[model samples]
Target: MVTSYVDEATGLLREDGKGSAQFEEVVLHPRVTVADASMAEAARAAHATAHDWCFIARSVNFPVRHEATVAVG
Candidate 1:
C-alpha cells in the first residue's frame, strides 16, 4: 500500500495528470484465510479502524495508501 503512494508521488502511477496523488484502498495480504467468512471480515474491520489512527492521512503532498495484513491461522 505504501508502495502505491510512493509510486504515485514519484510518478510511477499516473493518469491524465502529470504528477497527481490520490487516495487509494489497500487490501490485505491474500494469505489471510477464513475458516468462516467472518474471520477475514473481522480482520478487515480492524484494519479499517486502525487506518483512522495513522498520521499519513494528514499528508497532502502525496497520495496515501494503507497496507492491510490479514492473519491466517
Candidate 2:
C-alpha cells in the first residue's frame, strides 16, 4: 500500500497573518497479488474492510480516497 497526500496552507508567509495548514486530500493505493484473477474482487473487498476499520482514516476530516489494483500471478 502506498499513501500520498496534499497539504494546503493559508496565510503562512505573511508577516502579520496567522498560519494554518491542513491536508487537502489523501490517496491510498492498495495493490494485491493473487493466485487467480477471480480473487480480485475479494482482494478489493478486504482493502475496503481494512480502510473502514482504520482509526486514522475514520478520524481524519479530509477525504481519503482509495485506488485499488489487483494482479494475478
Candidate 3:
C-alpha cells in the first residue's frame, strides 16, 4: 500500500529535486497507518473532512514527505 501511494505521488508531485534548489523533508511521520482492527471507516471519514486543515499541509506547497511500510507477515 505504501509503495502504491509513493508511486502515485511520484506521478502527482515532482520527484524530490525536480523543482526548487533542492527538496528536503520538514517532517516525517514514522508510525501512521490504516489497520483492519481499527475504525477504518470513521478514520477515513473524519480525515476526508479534516485533512486539509492540517497546519503542515496548509503551510507547504509540496507534498508531505514520509515513508511507511507494513511488516511482512
Candidate 4:
C-alpha cells in the first residue's frame, strides 16, 4: 500500500498555479517473497532494483521512500 499526506489548506488543489503540488509526505509499503532461505538475500536486493525501475517513482522529483518486508513462504 502507498499513502500520501496532502496539505488541507490547499484544498487538495493540484498546484499553486506554479506547477508545484503539496505533498507533505509519501510512504510506500512493499512485500516480497522468496522460495527459500538461500534466496532471501537476493530477494531483498531485488526489492531495491524493483523500486528503482518503477516508472512513476522514477518520474517524480519528490523523494519516494518505502518500508518493505521480505518473507519465505
RMSD of 3: 8.5
lDDT of 1 at 51: 58
* Candidate-wise lDDT, in order: 0.47, 0.64, 0.42, 0.60
Candidate 3 per-residue C-alpha lDDT over 1-73 given as tens digits, one digit per residue, 9 for 90 to 100 = 2211222232132355656453343344333244442444544454444445668666876656433333221
Candidate 1 lDDT tens digits, 1-73: 1112111122233365767655343332323444554476776676577657656655545444545555444
Model 3 gets an lDDT of 0.42
Per-model tally of clashing residue pairs: 0, 0, 0, 0
Please give each candidate's TM-score. 0.36, 0.63, 0.34, 0.58
Q: Please report the candidate that would top TM-score against the real structure.
A: 2
TM-score of 4: 0.58
Q: List clashing residue pairs in candidate 1.
A: none
- Give the Å shift of residue 32 in candidate 4: 1.9
Q: Give the residue spans of candidate 3 off by over 4 A.
A: 1-20, 24-38, 65-73
What value of lDDT does candidate 1 attain over all alpha carbons? 0.47
Pairwise TM-score winner, candidates 3 and 4: 4
CA lDDT for candidate 2? 0.64
Candidate 2 lDDT, 10-62, residue by residue in tens: 22122334565567667777666777677768777987897788787789787
The residue ranges of model 1 lying beyond 4 angstroms of the native Cα positions read: 1-38, 67-71
**How do the candidates rank by TM-score, highest first?**
2, 4, 1, 3
